[model samples]
Target: MKKSAAYWIWTICLAPLIFLAVVWQKLPGRVPMHYNINGEADRYGSKNELLVLIGILFAVNIGTYLLLSNIHRIDPKKKYTAENLPVMKRFAFIITFFMTALSCFIIHTTLHAGSGFNGKFVVALIGLMIAALGNYMYNIKPNYFAGFRLPWTLESEENWKYTHRLAGRIWFVGGLVLTVLAFFLSEKAGFNVLMIITAIIVVVPTVYSYRFYKQNLNK
Candidate 1:
């Protein structure tokens, strides 16, 4: 991993922890820790519990970073490791950043439990992350740990390339639509849209890959 990327990852991973430490005294003894699908706080717990949750999230971020950074070393295929290293590192940073931002968002919400859940913001953030992944999805080589990883995509390089190329465009557009809808629709409507789009993005690529494989087999 590049020194700069590693530095940012650490900084991001620790941001929520630092924030919680600073605001520990200000938080109420009981805080809302979970929200329902309708974006209402349905669970409450002690502030101490929030600390434990954040700590666990931070550890998960570190674990994820380490895994992504060394994924190529563990995979049997070594031919594309050097070429894909940068993409992997960039993705690591992106994941770290997203997780950090999400942690911080949760902390902020915890502090203002009365504000209700900001489903739109959460959905928008998720959409943005998906868009980012889609933007780089085309660059990902066939690997066990990432990308589509379907049997068809893994067995044929052509299938992998074409499937991802089509997937990238579909995901990018779908992500943007989700982001836009998050703000305009009610919480329930937005949730429904998110699910539908998620299904489309995942299923389309899988079905396309299978059909592409069959066509190639017939050829």
Candidate 2:
């Protein structure tokens, strides 16, 4: 059978569920359901809760795919173009894959109770995700659902392009730096650095967008 985007989406989404089913019998009756900033398990729940969590993940992945696949129907201002569909599909795939990986990590950690799921690792993963997104940020067409949808960017197509291009670079570089720091710095110190980088990536684009808008308005 020819593979398609939907086929990949479903396959990626279902892999975790299948893994969970295979390992369900091996899991303890009570498992770590949540963790703290210090990479310690702070909450516990019945193993059955994993089933619930998996169900939710499946729903979110499928729901998000369906919603994005039909985003043009919901957004009144913009219709899906041939150019945007592949970008959107790729975005959806990235999100689903990330979620699947996260869920599997959670399950693995829960199974091995003492094995700490490093908070810094999650930070690093998020950093990598942001960096991956940056690669496509410039290609994202103006839409209500994604990208840096600030008032100024939404109001002006030029503002959107300029801001996204700038934001993409910032996020890509900042994310790599954050990922490196996550490995070297103490968890507390790494978390602080991550926040600072996050602020820079977000605030810089927002300020630039406003300025871009104003400059255009005055012209």
Candidate 3:
């Protein structure tokens, strides 16, 4: 069959959502689409609220893709051809798609009770590891919006350079730790661990960026 040119690609990004949609139908109890049932069972929520949540997520994905796709200037000064751009874009699309799928998987698995030990979150966790591997394999240079973005990493050329190098190492280690956590930890513990990891990832680079900025100022 003729496919969606972007087929399987961007679609992969939404696989978790599709899984949820399907699982929602298949599961014994009725799971609301928008609002999560919270800490209660056999409970339903306002449809409006549920739609809003989905809307927000939809917006986030579209916005994130747009922001990531266009942020880097294609080294305009270098001679490049249009033919190569699509393939290059596809690579990026794949990376981003995987990131989204992974994220949603993690969210879905963590939030629901019967989702088995590792449901979608484990998939997301795996996707993230693959992403890290891809980043290393492609030697894909980091940009402001891609792969371990931090203000310190983007503030200045030097900061950006040092930050990504640091970030790459951080993400690699973090991904590894999280991957193990995904397998062994209880779901609650796993989510807590993920949040802690995310916090460290966000806070560390931000603090480092400020320090780097100050040092540069002094120099």
Give the winner by lDDT. Answer: 1
Runs of candidate 2 with Cα error greater than 4 angstroms are 1-3
Candidate 2, position 184, lDDT: 91
Per-residue lDDT over 125-196 for candidate 3, one digit per residue giving the tens place of the 0 to 100 score: 553654464345223343433444555554465775566566556666776777776667666667677778
Q: Provide the lowest-lDDT 10-residue window in model 1.
A: 1-10
List, residue by residue over 161-215, the lDDT tens digit for candidate 2.
Answer: 8999998899889989988889998787888988999899989998988888888
| Residue 92 C-alpha lDDT in model 3 | 56
lDDT of each: 0.89, 0.82, 0.53
Per-residue CA lDDT of candidate 1, range 1-219, in tens?
Answer: 468766777888999999999999999999998899777898899998999999999999999989988999998768789877778877787788889999999999988888898989888888888888888888888888888899999999899999999898988889898999899998888888999999999999999999999999999
Evaluate model 3: give its TM-score. Answer: 0.57
By summed lDDT, the worst window of 10 consecutive residues in model 2 runs over 74-83
Question: What residue pairs are clashing in model 2?
Answer: none
TM-score of each: 0.97, 0.92, 0.57
Number of residue pairs clashing in candidate 1, backbone atoms closer than 3 angstroms, sequence gap of 3 or more or interchain: 0
What candidate 1 gets wrong by more than 4 Å, as runs, is none
